[model samples]
Target chain A: MKLTKEDIQFIDTYLENSDVVFADIRMEIVDHVASDIEDRMSASNTTDFYNVFKDYMVQNKAQLLKDNRQFLKSADMKIWKAFLKGLVSPLTPLIFLTSFFGFYFLYLNFNIETFRLIISYVPLIGLSGFLLTYVVYHKAKNLKRFSVVERLAMPFWVFYQIPNIIFNFSYQAKNLATVLWIVGIVSLVLTLMLVLVCVSIKLFKSYEKQYKTLA
Target chain B: MSNSKLYKGSLTTIILKLLNENDKMYGYEITQRVKELTKGELKITEGALYPALHKLEAEGLLDVEVAKVDNRLRKYYKLTETGTKETVNKLEELAEYIKTMQALVNPKLA
Candidate 1:
């Protein structure tokens, strides 16, 4: 009583289409559904994989996806809150405040054009770095080998791209005053991206260690 | 199957206790084990089981490992050190709750 590769692929496709794109969640659903189907097939007279799988999916898929989404939503909130807690703590907050005021005063008094430009583009740089890392390191290099949790967390990186989209469409920072205003917002976004990356990397490392023992 | 609502509250305790007894178990194996142990009186639905397992892992009460079995990757869950500690507490708490419920429901038995 086991599922074939084709059966697994078919389940994967179904899950992807049904908004179960996160690999971590997808893998669980796959295992649960596949196991149940195998048990059913073994007990029954029929050996048809498709029919058995379809029957189970028709009965249980919606409930399974609903339960998973509910869990992921809460889990995502907890992870975000933990990262936010770190960022808002005494030391980190003081450091960020000092950096912000330092940058603001430098731009305010000296009016350096290059510094202003770089400040204005901090959000764009952060977003680009995220995109580049994801495309090169994550998608290209190790997507095939990534554990389920890693794949699930990939979609959350889209949050970093939001600031990039805002900057692209509405940005008109030609002067230091405009640069100062936009830079603050951009720097905030950049900090958030950094926090997200740190949390993701930490999570990936733990997940990798957990899976490595099985390998 | 028993009432899902009643069983829901105790699901985590049940899972932890099972993992405490066994070395490791995959999703299907866990469900089957529950069924066999309960003699078909309890059924762990896929909807309930997977979400509960994921939540437990997120809470650091369980750890997961994946291996290639029968040409497909099978993810197995085992209790972590913290999870082992938690199981004892949960079981004792559950035992207390059950005793209270028994007293209320069946005074003679209590």
Candidate 2:
């Protein structure tokens, strides 16, 4: 007892009206409800989609919606935890060390003004480039509206302001020690930004692969 | 049947064990399989089942694949390599727990 396209659409519309709006989540729920309805219809040897759907909803809608909310929260938490874990991963020290030496070299070779300009603009440029690439990838893949992708992008957007924050504080350093401290801090920030970019790319690639294969 | 709480704690193990036996399963299929296996003794609600599935997924213990079935897309879940390994450990843990409970609840059976 396969449901008609109209039956499927009816369930989709019902869910959307109930605020289960994310396509990824809605898609799964729609299938679940449709499957449930089909099973009931077959078992009863009747094809009353509306009555079966209504009964299923009466019994299950609240719980389904609750599960959807719980999933969203847990998904957000998992993404943040993964991002934070990536920040302190084994590769992080290497990135930090390289960034430290790189910043130290720039500070030594360039005048303070030039160093400040380079430090400020380099991360900004890098972040901007990453943002652009992320946007273009989503646009090309047509995955812009996925709730999971939006959650994954949240940390990157939050960390995107790190460069400007560092830039603002870079001006306050007066002595060599203070400058050294700033350099170390900037290197740390760079490492964080780099890790954020890597994690985002890894997660996005995994999802892109999943979606592509599924498609 | 009256001891859903007893089963609540074991849902993850149940899901992993099912996926371990079967290659992959969708949400509705998993529910139906459980129902059939239990002979109507245990029923997993959508609220409990999906959150559990998503949690396992977030933990990287499950991987999802979507296929268009009939008129719509259906999401299927399967155990990952880590998940497959974890399934064995979880089953062992569950076995131990059940033994302890049996010994406590029915010494003659133990």
Candidate 3:
């Protein structure tokens, strides 16, 4: 028994009301429930979608929603693991080295005060720009909210505030060694952020591909 | 059949073994397959099944592919290269475990 569009919409509405708000996770659950209801309707020789759905929910809703709550944590773990894996990938060191040398070159050529200001502000500016672009891109593409992709952006949010925290502390490098240390740390942070952005884009594209056929 | 705990430890292996045999399977299909293969003695619930799938996916052992089927999108899980290799290892480990349990449960059979 194939479910009608209205039947699917009912399931979607029910899940949303039940707090299954993330579209990616909700899509999977909707499919699972719809499939189960179809199987029941076929076996029982009944077309009463509501009765079948209600009965199924009575037996399964608690379990399903319980598992749903864990989705965010699962997504968080997956994102962090991906980020860590990205950090250790062979390309990371190359990116780090290249950025390190590039930053160090600028440091040598540019005035020290201007160099420090650029290093401090670049991550903040870059993070804001990335967020703006990400929001607009997703809106333009009409991509659904995915928990994994949302979690992937979390580290950048934390990184975005670091410059402000340092500014508040008014910490300044006093010597070449201190300046070099700051440069190295900034290079590493930039490399990590770049890797995270790459991972985020990869994840977004994967999800986009998964749902591309949807109307 | 009443003790889900007995099967809990082997859930990952069961999933891997199934994916090893079948090219790809979705959540509902995997559960139904388990019930069918076990002659209804083992039923994999959705609560238990999705988490396992997600964990294996996180571990880089399973790859997910989504496609439009019927009126909805179906998320199918398949064994990655690492997952394929790990399935063999898990199956071997499970066999050894069954052997140990068999020896303990029925000494003469050992």
lDDT of 3 by residue, A82-151 (tens): 8888788899999889878887888789887777777877586547646764786478887766788777
The candidate that achieves the highest DockQ relative to the unseen native structure: 3
> Please, what are the lDDT tens digits per residue for candidate 2 over residues B29-76?
998999999998999877778878988988889999988789788899
> Which 10-residue window in model 2 chain A sums to the lowest lDDT?
A141-150
**TM-score (0 to 1) for chain A, all models?**
0.64, 0.80, 0.85
- In angstroms, give how far residue A49 of model 2 lies from its true place: 1.7
Interface RMSD of each: 3.5, 2.3, 1.4
Model 1 C-alpha lDDT per residue in residues A13-35, reported as the tens digit of each score = 88879887666566667777777
In candidate 3 chain B, where is summed lDDT lowest over 10 consecutive residues? B1-10
lDDT of candidate model 2 versus the reference: 0.81
lDDT of 2 by residue, A1-215 (tens): 99988999999889889988677788878988898889899999998889998899898888888877976777687677677779778999998899889988998888888888988875675476467657866777665345565676666566666766877877876788878888887888778777877777776776666666432
Ranking by TM-score: 3, 2, 1
Best by lDDT: 3
Q: What is the TM-score of each candidate against the true structure?
A: 0.74, 0.85, 0.89
lDDT (10s digit) by residue, model 3, range B39-106:
98998877778878898999999999988787777899999999999999999999999999999999
> Looking at model 3 chain A, which ten-residue stretch has the lowest summed lDDT?
A163-172
Which scores greater on TM-score, model 1 or model 3? 3
The per-model lDDT (C-alpha) reads 0.70, 0.81, 0.83
Q: Model 2: what is its DockQ?
A: 0.58
Model 3 residue B83 CA deviation (Å) reads 2.2
Q: Compute fnat per model.
A: 0.43, 0.69, 0.55
